[model samples]
Target: MSVSVGIYSVPLVCEAVPQIGCGCLAKPVLARLEVHPDIAEAWLHHRGDVIAIKWLRELGVDQQVGLLRAALGGDGDSQVALVAAASSSPLLATFPNPSYWYQRETVDQLSQEEAHTIAARLVQRLSQARVPLPDGTALQCDLACALQEVLVVDEAMPIEARLARLLGVARDTFQQHLGSQALSQLDAWLTPAALLPEDAG
Candidate 1:
């Protein structure tokens, strides 16, 4: 008997980027739709839907499809590359230190150098991926939104201060708000600003 591995296929439904919400586009525009919960979880975790919509605007449905196709773990190479890249990044590296130190007397957790290094790595990966992101205004907006979600989960800052910097909000703010009602709000708040178009820029 022969065995199979390293073979993958995206449902025809995934061929054209699905319009996120309320567009004049007809339903079932693409064919053979199939979605597994695991894929949905991964997409949700990484805010992949938002990322895909933004990319679709420039690259068109075809290119978006290509990226998604390539993203689906061809020969396990693409999956491994994405996983290695995400795991090796510094943001993930420094994420745990602060959590471990929360109750300790030491206020000094992540160093300025550490912060800068992680930020640089994120930027570098974004650059290396060669993805065309939104302009500064749009990027800033998106970051602000993402940061806000992070703060909601961490809930350590004054709401006023929290609103001031959305994307990449300071680590201090994160530590302060780690346990708050904001987290509850997140569960109920379904549509994130992260999913909005960058047309504001």
Candidate 2:
């Protein structure tokens, strides 16, 4: 008996496949697709977004003010970091609401001098936090002072790199120290409701 090998062809189902139509291939169509709502919203929020006071009532006035200053200082990376932290944190769910952009727009209405005043208050609040710099650190300045200097006062090259060197620690370590200490201090002032975990306290 001779065995015959048979090859079967499967038909390609265009409907089942996710395909861009020919119209989408056009330059004008592709150009129009560049406007992504999510990216646009994120950009708008990052550019001088405001933190709503009612949402941030869990934090002390100074901490809230400091965060606001940080957000409004044109530090998009910092704002994005804060939003990411809040999104990931079990205790900070209600913050950074979808309407947060409107609050930021309101902040934008403030005069330049007012923005400066807010930044000054933030610096003062950070100075009061008095988080210690790493041991044998080159900088003799207070940790908060150093943070403000690198983050707000100076437009230093490679801010994180310089900050790590000043703190005598790795970049990741410096970030962790700053974030954890700041969060810890803020957590101390959070309301009981805000402190509750997703399921239980």
Candidate 3:
């Protein structure tokens, strides 16, 4: 039987994007949606209340959504490509642990390259820090995603809903700030400079 979510008849479940407070389709849901016969197009956008059914075709043959966002966020830089590879690679598991080397003369640890890769990914996000979403209001967002998302409402919307949207935006902004700080800490700790310090000062 076909399922319906909110106003759409398509069997789609919207979930919050991790670390960025934006709406994202759950992967399993997307895997199902990808093959749905009724769906002419399915776009897994980083924002929007529902997945953009028309956006899928824009992804083209190389339609891995993560790579698309990585390219966009990094401005098509090679460094972003490297970081994207590491994010998907299981090889990251093999990287040595991070710890103090003062106690031991020699310690096994991640290479500088590996550390940089990790550091880059730690700060990586699926979308820009903030996006304006027209609140039709793009599915229900009780807890919201972890990033900064601004909700724009039609003038006709009720004041209560508008106020609610404003509050949601405020929460998202705060959450984004905390996420940024945490990622920065991770970046500083795992970057090449931290791992292979020439000055050690």
Cα-based lDDT for every prediction: 0.27, 0.29, 0.28
lDDT of 2 by residue, 1-201 (tens): 222111111111111111211110111211221232211211122122222222312444345344433333423333322333433343224334433222222222222222233234333433455645443232222333443333222222442354344333222233454556555553342322221122432
Shift in Å, residue 11, candidate 1: 46
lDDT of 3: 0.28
Candidates 1 and 2 compared: the better one by lDDT is 2
> Which sections of candidate 3 miss by over 4 Å?
1-25, 54-201
Worst 10 residues of 2 by lDDT: 7-16
| Candidate 3 lDDT, 15-131, residue by residue in tens | 111221111122323334446454443332221122323232333323433443332343223311212343423322322222211001111111122223222332332112332
Higher-lDDT candidate of 1 and 3 = 3
Cα error of candidate 3 at position 80, Å: 33
- What TM-score goes with each of the models? 0.18, 0.19, 0.20
On the 0 to 100 scale, the lDDT of residue 166 in model 2 is 31
Model 1, range 30-56, lDDT digits (tens) per residue?
111113211211111111121111111
Provide the lowest-lDDT 10-residue window in model 3: 101-110
Q: Model 2: C-alpha RMSD to truth?
A: 23.6
Backbone clash numbers for all candidates listed: 9, 1, 6
- Residue pairs with clashing backbones, model 3: 20-146, 20-147, 21-145, 21-146, 21-147, 49-138
In candidate 1, where is summed lDDT lowest over 10 consecutive residues? 22-31
